[model samples]
Target: MAKILMITGDFVEDYENMVPFQALLAMGHEVDAVCPGKRKNETIATCIHDFEGQQTYTEKRGHNFTLNANFDDVAASDYDALYLPGGRAPEYLRLDSKVLAIVKAFMASNKPVAAICHGAQLLTAANVIEGKKVSAYPACAPEVRLAGAEYVELQMDEAITDGKLVTAPAWPAHPAMLKHLVALL
Candidate 1:
């Protein structure tokens, strides 16, 4: 079983954070969900982002997600893979030096890294997507391209995998993204 590390923060997308964490566990993988400044058992409020025939997605408060690991205690070498779930969290997480360092460590080690939606922000901030092929939420396409990665715009349920990196547009692509991540593991 692979030891997977899921990095998230407050306001993380509800489905993006919960679905993968549970699905990975159901697949026999051990996942440690963590957040900066948060310890095991601590919870982070999550938000639900849904497209309701509006010009953009709608956001609502979601369930509180619990962390199972400590960020300060994490060593990228200790995990076999990384999961980055999209939400408002990435907007700030990408700015954290520690978070960027962890992201760099995973990419540097060639470990499988799966990022979805706004999660791509961290990859861009980490400067690890250069020369890679990726797919992200449409709004994030510009950033992905600016990071030197070829952004493949696809349906919400589609996913793109380039070597050890797997990316998807949003939670709607969880099935494909999770499948690709399992293969990488």
Candidate 2:
């Protein structure tokens, strides 16, 4: 089993993001869910869940996935792969120098890095998406292109791999993304 480290955002997709976690666990891979900080009394970081008629803060949800520490505590040498779950967290994480450093380290090390939805935004900031084909939320098309990546509009269920990097559009694409990632593990 591969040691997989996942970086989560503050408002991650509750169910969609959980698919890969569940799959990795079932495959006996050691998965570490990391975030910016500890959330009080919550095993996972809590986030607002919007399901049409239902929307509220859901504790112990996907967004609530706890981390061992901030980006500083992690070293790129420690894991075989990295997964970034999309949400508002990427907006802030993308700007963090430490996080960008980690992302660069992963890319330079040729570690398998998987990013979805807005999480791809972090890659843009790291300047690691250049000359690659990537997919993300529609709003980020120009941003990805500006980073020198070719943007493709596709469903989340499809997996797009470029060298050791994997990307998907959004939550709905978790299945295929997770499947490809797990296989890499």
Query: Which segments of model 2 are wrong by more than 4 Å?
Result: 39-63, 68-71
Q: Give the lDDT of residue 79 in candidate 1.
A: 98
Q: Give the local distance difference test score of model 1.
A: 0.96
TM-score of each: 0.99, 0.83
Residue 58 in model 2: lDDT:
29
For residues 1-185, what per-residue lDDT tens digits would candidate 1 score against the true structure? 99999999999999999999999999999999999999999999999999999988999999999899999999999999999999999999998999999999999999999999999999999999999999988999999999999999989999989999999999999999999999999
Which portions of model 1 show Cα errors greater than 4 Å? none
The sequence of per-residue lDDT tens digits that candidate 2 reaches over residues 1-185 is 78887776566766545767777778898777766554323355445433354342223444455444445467778889988877667888787787888889999999899988788898999999899999886768899999999998887457788888888877778778887777676
Error of 1 at 23 (Å): 0.4
Q: After superposition on all CA atoms, what RMSD does each candidate show versus the true structure?
A: 0.6, 4.0
Checking candidate 1 for backbone clashes, the offending pairs are none
Question: lDDT (CA) for every model shown?
Answer: 0.96, 0.75
